[model samples]
Target: YADALRVAQEAAEALPIEKDAIVGANFLLGLAQIEAHTGQSKEVVKTLRQLLTIPAGEYVSLTRLKIDPVWDPIRNDPGFQKLLSEPEPETVYR
Candidate 1:
């Protein structure tokens, strides 16, 4: 899981901001899932927020976050709850 998180973080970082949602969202979602499984609640929420900043394509959506078992670990977190309640972030890029 740690290795997966590391690789995901690296892949997400390697992408240019304008192209982040195209592929980086997948890496960030993987990182968030790894963090959630490994009990990194804060990191999981933080990573999910980062995922939200992108276009929230295949890897993320309010419905997915609420229903995905992978996020159950952090489901009780206030940050996670807030994320679920709030509208999706504005899309600055394609």
Candidate 2:
């Protein structure tokens, strides 16, 4: 878990913010998984928040967070629970 966390962190950092949004989301998902597995609830929730900022995609979703066993460790975290309960933000386009 420690190794996985380290690698995920590194990969996430190495990703270019503009060009790799989707890939970065995937790395965030991996980091969240590692953090949850290693009892780092705070870090896991933080990572999930980061993932949530990415546009709707294939990596993480409120539904997955609610149901996936991988996120069970942080499921009860206030931050995580708040994320689940909050209404989806309104997206506006010009």
Candidate 3:
């Protein structure tokens, strides 16, 4: 679980800016799905919340939540859904 979180963290770092990696959204979704399957929802939420902080998250996160069976626990949580829809900080590359 910890390792998975670490991997997810690393994946998030690779795409801090939208222009850098078009695949960022897919990577975050995959990582969140994996975490949701094997760990506590708290951990899943924690990792995913961190991952979902990527640029232009809305549908990338929501669509993942909607489709992933592993995230069922959080699928209905308002906070979880909000993370998908809320405005994230605009990411900029130096």
lDDT, candidate 1, 1-94, per-residue tens = 7787778778777874456555666666777888888778888878777767777756777878988888888889887898899998765555
Model 1 alpha-carbon drift over 4 Å, by segment: 15-21
lDDT of 3 by residue, 1-94 (tens): 6787778768866774354544676666666666665645565567566555555455445565668666776676666666667665354433
- What CA RMSD would you report for each candidate? 2.2, 2.6, 5.0
Predicted structure with the largest TM-score when compared to the true one: 2
Least well predicted 10-residue stretch by lDDT in candidate 2: 85-94
TM-scores of all candidate predictions against the true structure = 0.75, 0.79, 0.46
For model 3 the local lDDT of residue 84 reads 61
Clash count in backbone of candidate 2? 0
Better of 1 and 3 by lDDT: 1
User: Cα lDDT of all candidates, in order?
Assistant: 0.76, 0.74, 0.61
Q: Report how far residue 16 has shifted in candidate 3, in Å.
A: 2.8
Instruction: Name the regions of candidate 3 deviating beyond 4 angstroms.
Output: 38-64, 76-78, 81-94
Top candidate when judged by lDDT against the true structure: 1
